[model samples]
Target: MPLIEIKHEGLHKYRVIKGNDQYVVEQKARVQLQQWDEMWNKKQEAERKKIEREKAAIEKVQKKAMAEQQTQDAIDELEMIDNTLIYTLEIDDRIDWDSLKDLSDFKDPKPIAPNKPLYSSEPQKESYKPKYKLWDKILPSIKQKKIDESMKVYEEALDIWKNETEKINSKYEKEVDEFKERLKNWEEEKESFEREQKEKNDAIEKRKEQYLSGESESIIDYCDMVLSNSNYPDYFPQEFDIDYNSQNKTLIVEYILPDISDLPTLKGVKYIATKDEYKESYLSETVVKKMYDKLLYDITLRTIHELYEADAISAIDSIVFNGWVNTLNKATGKKQDICILSIQTNKEEFLEINLKLVDSKSCFKNFKGIGSSKLFSLTPIAPILKINREDSRFVDAYNVTGKVDEDTNLAAMDWQDFEHLIRELFEKEFNTSGGEVKITRASKDGGVDAVAFDPDPIRGGKIVIQAKRYTNVVGVSAVRDLYGTVMNEGATKGILVSTADFGPDAYNFAKDKPLTLLNGNNLLHLLHKHGHKAKIDLKEAKLIMKEK
Candidate 1:
């Protein structure tokens, strides 16, 4: 319809179509305007949705921090409970209340008074509902005004829409900028995480090779890492220390024993619905001790088992285990770390025993490795082999500063590096042996340092090499131990290389044995014969070492 000025519905002027064809022009213009309005509204709605999603993303990141804090708090509570031994306990033997009246410390038990609840009922959850818009009434009214060309109320309505739309667009633009910043941060964080992961994997691979070739400090650090990640029962603390001796190829494990005094004796408490009270049930002290003893024994076995199962442990030929408890001695009124149990078992011997079928009480006895009789009694026992801190693998050296110069001579290189250098020298010498020779981890393993299998078909057998960096004359004791190791391992021949000359007694002992002793001169010659330059000067080595 065509607009014509006329009084209608309290308006001084209203739009009307005079003829049939004139109304078509007005309707077409109305359609075009309506399309423009609808397109703009769609654009605004799309941006509103985008803004909402970004807000949700920000909220999720905030919630993650809160969740992590909650998890850490729960773990702390469990640790405290474990240390205090407040787990459920059972009491079978009742104490007579009247008999303790004469004692100054005697007192009757009192029921605990209940305190207020931590909080009111948890926050209620409500379903979400979208807002209702009056677009039906408002849209039609605005279209009629625009079509009539009133320009007064029509322009006012447009101004309001434009202003509101602009406000929303401004808000959405700000949100988008914030979202973009967050996205950049997330990308940077991800890249950094990937870099860190790559570094960690590289370190693991390098350490794996070092560990397999008789560098076991990596194994100790690996075990600690695994245990640190392990989820122990709430309240239980896992603490341990380890060292390796390459000579006999033995791992020395010093583990902290858990306090069992607070172990729960009660099986459970039954809530009497009729009386509105709980009936406590407790186990006898003897029963509690027996349970704790079994638990302690199980823990000891599990620790050793986890280490043995690790693929990284290549050279641990045997283990010397010790569990100590830190407590105050009533008699001395001094804190002491009392070694409750100590056992030594070779890898060959330990692998033959089955843990499932063996009782914890009889495990030590069956292995013939127990050195102490008072596990539960807490009697202290001296460790047969003490940990050599100097033996710590360079790769896992913690709290160490100032890099050690790798190019330095034998006197300056640490024991692990010295052993590694020797392995490299020998590996080069036996490169044509047709098989890879591996060094056993630095541990007390009789006297074998590295093992090589010479496959000449006729001379195909195990060959052992011992690297002795001693500045003094190689003694008969070392040669004898090497010979013993060769016999124990059933090797065809053994070689012992030293940085110093062997005594007459060492040569006498090796002359009849299936062993060859290489002095400092011979070792250098062999290394040089294999296209490697190396020299051992005992006097110079001693002077350099003593400078420390």
Candidate 2:
């Protein structure tokens, strides 16, 4: 059963409240109720607006869908009509050749020509002229007159021949006399020429005797005396050591000099000699050797100049190598190594000499070496170093630490420069495409030594890079760690760089993964590919690593 509820009544004394206070309480309560009602109305209005907006959005989507469907339906109906037309055309194959034939021309027709002559005709006649008097008709009388004239002419010719014979005899006698005089003059001239030649031979023989007997202090002195007597003072002293057993007498003077550097001016000197001596001199060993050396030097210089002229710097080493080899071949009785060394030294000297040749010209300016040695050393790092400093990612990677070795401190400095150069090359080749690169020293624990970002804008995302400057082979574990990092970072690719070669397992593991491994040889190739050269040798690098 439901419990019965009892109502309690208040005392009548409590009903004595102020009239204004009751009205104020009632008004305050009414205001609160009105506020709540206004709030509710606002909420309802907002909800209604939201519903209307949703309905409008749905209508917009529906209209767009309907428009798209209408376009598709139009396309489909057009396609169906086209198919029906094609079917109807395909079924209609009947021909109407009878209708196409012309009714006016059904029979073969004959060819007719206009009535006219093919050619104009007229009576033909030859235009001819006849001679009145032929030579045979007039010759009989003329022959007699000619015979009489011939007899007279023969008599005159005989008289003239007798006179002419006497005059020709006299003229022949005078010519013979003149010829004899000319012969005598020629004989005198010949004697003079012979005497002069004999004197020249005597002088050359004396000079030769003086050279052979060591009477002259030096061959150069004799040559200078000989040349000083003539116009040219800068004559090449003959090399007299070589003996030639020729029918004609030959004078050979040996000029002793340390090197061929001073041979330029000497090469231009001319010598005046008798024909016989000149012919005999060609067979002399001294002449042959001098000519051969001069020729060789000239050819080598020409080839080198041609290569330089063609702007072929890569061929310089090959030129040097071939030049050294040829020089060694010519250097008989000399030590091979010494000859090679001399050739190398001479090559360097030749470079300067060539420069001097150009420098002699008034318009030519002085040229420096362009630091080829330094550039060559840095070549192996060029591919790794970005030419544009702004594009280099590892520009701040390795700081210039303090000197490593005092004795080879320059080498240490070079190494530092090379390190920076390598970093620059890597930045250019690997990170120039708006990719990010981070370089840091490997921690004691040996995780990732460096990280690089390779972004693919079209596909979206970045790649990870790990560089290791190890002297030994990079192991598989490093590659594995890089792969893991790549996976963790959600990268599309990974790269591992090492100064040394990569281990077999490293490559095998990276084969399937989107990983690129650059080892020592590859690194060198890349450097060379981009015009970077390795200044330090492998042995030197190994030694430095060992020392470290």
Candidate 3:
């Protein structure tokens, strides 16, 4: 029935006796309590063990659930990619510049009065009047004396209250003045902001009017805004350059596309219970390639459609989209950008088709887009037309070839001298075809080291050249900048020559983009070809620079 019963005495001990055996009570009670304590300890230990087991089981289940959630997320991402074009169709591509204006009024400061001091209200004059009783009449002298004392005390109290009231009024007046100053400052700031807002709105209106009038630069700027406002997945690169031709009302867009390697590869994540680890599955190569091709096609068509739909002013009749990708070249182990697709579609033809019902790849084919059938392979193709180059930043150039010799180390030459030397050599090379090279002014080059105009119709046009005289290797950034210059200048080609050498990435980026990169060896060969020789010693150049 009961294991043990305990009795309490004073603080000295608890009588944890088991049974009433009066002869051997002490020894039998001790033994029974010892057994009972051991049994209680075992029960507590069993409870702790059960809790640990449940905790471990719950953790395992949570891990598996997390893995399942990850798998579902990956699947959702893939679905979004598959419907990229379809999703974009629902968005209104036009920009509402009015809604973007900041018209919120400034909040005015509320007037806060000072807390008034608890000053006693003016004492009533009649309350201090002395009472005249019958006994006071019998003692007229005493009563008159009392009345005089009371009047003196009342005058003294009134004087003290007047002083306290003055101090409180002074404090209240000071607080009011301080609040007035703060309000004045706030009003000044609000006025200045209102003026700025008015100017901003005026500028926006002017730009809108220019865009409506079909101004060349204004049209390009508006198109840029349209593209910037378009939403895309975070994985996509939103970098692009635009050029508009007013005569035919055509816009050319050079957009940087994300590489296939940059896309998410995990098809699903699975939790392996036996190993207690997560395993990820990936899409097959063939499936990825097919999806990549379709995506490229979707992007090509979607870009053109958006621009056409957003052209509310009817200034643009057609758009040309050239999709370019920056990636590492496996063959050369260098980074380069290749134009994977180019498509031109007019407003009339593009608006006639129901985009939601058409397959992206088939629609692109119907419009005769330029690209390889298998786009994942990163094949290069020529654009139907190039942006026109009409830069006016070029100034009258000076000559520097009269100062060069066989002993001249180009790596140690002045930067300005190096640019002129490059210009002279190119001049000699292009002279055979009646082309001339001109070096831009040193202070106003605007990212253009030199400019060359070739007279040959088939192989010649405005070519932009940049010179880099570096003791270290030229990286991909310089090469990428050259490509941007080529697009901005509207040149037929771009050339980058360095005195030291180029990094692997620089070489990679120059591929297929009408760009030329000449390393130290190539520079030496070009000089030798022109019956002149120059050394490119980077180590000596560094030493000279350090000494200077």
Candidate 4:
């Protein structure tokens, strides 16, 4: 009898029993293997958990470091903004006209060649070799049968190969045609691109010529391009309107300044690893206010310097920069736009100052720029001069004062004549200080009845005038419209003149706004002061209207 041999892991054992039964031994080995497997699995699970905890700890540390880096970056950004004027001194403010052109040349797309099928040779038939054996001479018919079968199979394979080759050739022809079509489309696209590029280059050249010719509109456009190309932080509004006065070669810029609230209040961030939380610290209100004031001063001086330096064509002799802010009025709880700072300086005078060495606010004051001591207060200040927008809506005005007398009730006058009469009165009012007033087209003036161009640099600018020849009292709606028009037109002030008195709400609405509400009495006083006499008899005019 053979001896029973049992192997268990590294141990070998031979056992002799009454019967050679391996079932019991196999069962014992299986139980031992399961126990070892359980132990190994537990060990692997413990190691995996340890790795996960370590990974999580590392990720938390990385996150805390990243948060700290972001806080520092924000602080650095604020510091950069504080030195805006100084940093800009190193930059070249002039516009390189050539750089504005599309300098990238057209590149022909890579041609895709037709995928020709690989040349496949026709299948050749193999020659049949007769099998030789001792009995082959006696069995020639069997060998012949085998040779015929081989020839038939070879013929069938040759026919199949011919068909496949034909299909491949046909596909190759179609691919060639498609390639030609694609090439034609590419050619047309290239032609169109070249034409467009040529047209664009021509337009740029024309604009350059116009800008160099000292054309007022073209100069304004060039200045706008120069300003638009400037790089600023994302928080900056960077919105501005530019106007050029060719007569005086002065460029007027109405720039939108960022409010104090627009800046980042966060000073730093700290991470608590135990709590797994980040705590942020913020700048105090006093520091924020100081930053706001310094930033405004920097912007004012920086803008003036940029325009002046970029005036390579000598198109700009002087610059009038008005810094406006759009912010919520805490008192009224509504949006308000007000000019916070204004500076008018010639290029010669402004360029002489070394911006890197001087303090921003002090330099601004040295130039006699007007602003409140604390710019964060949002105090409204008058500009030295404002951009006079050329409005095509203004039509020539006829003398309405020449046709009016004391008895000529303004309330009874024609609505169109009343509008012209208001223009004449204002013309007379501003004429003493070299101001001119023009009446806009009737019904098409876009809510503007008249516009006063007052040349008084200190207090004069574009004044929007709306004339309401109402026999009844004027409501606040008209006053609100005047305010909106002033903002839309970028005017320094708005004057609402009515034949009758304004309601108390109308006056209240105009309060704290750059609006002047002239009731019947005020209108009469203005008329008398301008050496013109007119009467605003609303009650008499109402009775006369009933008769009609």
Model 1 TM-score (2 dp): 0.39
Better model by TM-score: candidate 2 vs candidate 3: 3
Best candidate, lDDT: 4
Per-model TM-score on C-alpha atoms: 0.39, 0.25, 0.68, 0.58
Q: For residues 341-457, could you state the per-residue lDDT of candidate 1 as single tens digits?
A: 777766677767776567766887666645455355666777756665341212221211123222344534566666666666665656775544566666765556777656443
Each candidate: how many clashes?
Answer: 32, 20, 4, 0
- How accurate locally, in lDDT, is each candidate? 0.59, 0.41, 0.80, 0.81
**Stretch of 10 with least lDDT, candidate 1:** 86-95
- Model 2 Cα lDDT, one tens digit per residue, 1-548: 21222221321111211234656655655555566567667877999999998987776666556555655554554344223212222221221223322233213232232332233222122211222245535776665565566666666666666676667667766767776777676666665555544533453454445445543122323323332222111322221111111222222211121123222211121222322111111124454345334332332333333332322122122222112211122437542211111011123334455333332211111211111122111111111111121322333565322222223322223433435444455556655556555554434544444455443334323445565656567888888777665554334577776667788978866775578998766766676666644432446666866787
Score candidate 4 by lDDT. Answer: 0.81
lDDT string, candidate 3, 60-92, tens digits: 899899999999999998888888788778888
lDDT of 4 by residue, 92-172 (tens): 999888977776767987469876689677767654344556565678887677678877877887788888888998889
Positional deviation of residue 334's Cα in model 1 after best superposition, in angstroms? 4.4
Models ranked on lDDT: 4, 3, 1, 2
TM-score attained by model 4:
0.58
- In angstroms, give how far residue 362 of model 4 lies from its true place: 0.3
**Best by TM-score, which number?**
3
Candidate 1: list runs displaced more than 4 Å. Answer: 1-193, 212-214, 229-231, 273-275, 311-313, 371-374, 390-548
